[model samples]
Target chain A: MDALIEKLKGQIIEQLNLAEVKPEEINPDSPLFGEGLGLDSIDALELIVLLEKHYGIKIQDPKDGKTIFQSLRTMAEYIKSQGKS
Target chain B: MDTITSYAHIKHNQVSVNGEIIFQSYPSLSLPEFLSEAYKALGVSYPKFHKMDAQCKLGFLCTEFTLNGTSFLTENDITKTAIVLSNAASSLETDRVHQHSIDDKSNYFPSPAVFVYTLPNITIGELAIKHKITGENAFFVSEQFDAGLLVNYTETLIQSGTEASVMGWVEVDGTNFEAFIFLAEKQKYTNKNAIFKPLNKTSVITIYNQTIWTH
Candidate 1:
């Protein structure tokens, strides 16, 4: 679980090019959008692609991604539920 | 009085004015292809072009030809020159890609790589760096081409004793891109002796509004 969270954090940083951000700075349970990580709609699409490419999760609907990508904890739980991790 | 001796341009490697072609070269294959070819022709590294956004690349191409290999003025002379450019889209391509990221949830994250090009001023920044032009730089956006605004601003600079003003219109829509430039200087001449005439604001508004080039 810890390793998966680390991997996810790395991916977020790389995909977003969060220049000043480090992996350790992201809180696993913190919100990934708006308040916490401050990611917007565009970042959400990139994250969705990251899921599909890395974990074989296909997000066919944008609305469904809101719940799944709320935070690292939610994303990790979803990935585990899908037997992806 | 300062005077424009000559003007030159290269679109797809062909220097031209109006419909008259001064020099012609083969058209580029694609955006990437053109960038690569331009980099090679200028003897700059390929990676450098890759690092630059589209607008910067286009601005560089236009400005390089405008200078025509003239030795850039030293720091003391730098204050005498200025750059004034106009564009239609103003980084819409960057905006489009950024909007795409938001429209599609599957791509929930935006790449910072794409975000940096969102501003229209990056082109001017690129031009200043390449040409070492440190005087004045301004970028204006219009609904369509405004030759009068360009001419008037350049004339103002010339009249103020600026050595020269590099002014132009650069517009890109999808795959089509056009750049028109004039290197101007102030001169005392009657209407008949004036090689370049400044169009009145009303005439400019009409021409731009109607998309009429021939007066």
Candidate 2:
């Protein structure tokens, strides 16, 4: 779980072109949108593409992204639940 | 009288304001590196600037520098300011990236972040959002910097109640790019430090051409 969280952090940074953000700075339990990483709608879409491109995880419902991308931990857990982690 | 108050030019890995060299990284940084260096040197905190494509970044940085030379915003209602810009490439750089993303049918993923900047006018949208400009705006794609078009259209807007304007050319095609942005006003400024050029075809052509030929 720890390894998966770290991996997701790197992926999110690279996928979103967060050049100023280091993987270590992203707290796993912190939110990915609004108050935390401060990602917007466009970044949310990019995160969706990241999941599909890297993990082969296709989110059929866009609404589920709110829960899946809540934080680094949630994203790792989602991938683990899909057996991709 | 309508006058061109302050202006900035970006090219050859250099950023100049009002015909004076303001910043340039030695060894001529790559387009991305140059833009990042210029943004850092400008000392602005627009977080969304990170997500913008090359074209928008080029225009955004140039506009910021142009506006830096004057107190136009503080003196005038920015909401009534018009923005008229022209470009040679029309977002072709980002268009190619978006096209490549969807080209491989077997491994296709079009990024919304990249895809949103597919249009040339997104550059204008970026400036509008950043400056809180709610007035008229337009983006024209021409073979080169059409000084006549820019001068005519921008002056027309200012004459028709637009308080001030930011106009010029911003072009980004692959690794080749340049931007010449200037601020113009509806009336002559009485600011002790203000040095404005007549908003006419001759001055526009002269400055825009000078920047183009400058290294």
iRMSD (Å), candidate 1: 7.3
lDDT by residue (B130-149, candidate 1, tens digit) is 65677677789998768777
Residue-by-residue lDDT tens digits, candidate 2, B47-119: 7888899999999999999888578888778789888999888889999999999999999999999999999
> After aligning candidate 1 to the native by TM-score, how far in Å is the CA of B40 from where it should be?
2.1
Q: Which of the numbered candidates is closest to the native, going by highest DockQ?
A: 2
Clashing pairs in 2: none
Q: In CAPRI terms, where does candidate 1 land?
A: incorrect
**Tens digits of per-residue lDDT for model 2 on A1-85?**
9999988888888889887788988999999999889998999999989999999999999999999999999999999999997
For model 2, state the Cα shift of residue A47 in Å: 0.8
lDDT of 1: 0.65
Error of 2 at B1 (Å): 1.0
Candidate 2 versus truth, CA RMSD in Å, comes to 2.0
Q: TM-score, chain B only, every model?
A: 0.71, 0.93
**Model 2 chain B worst lDDT window (10 residues):** B206-215
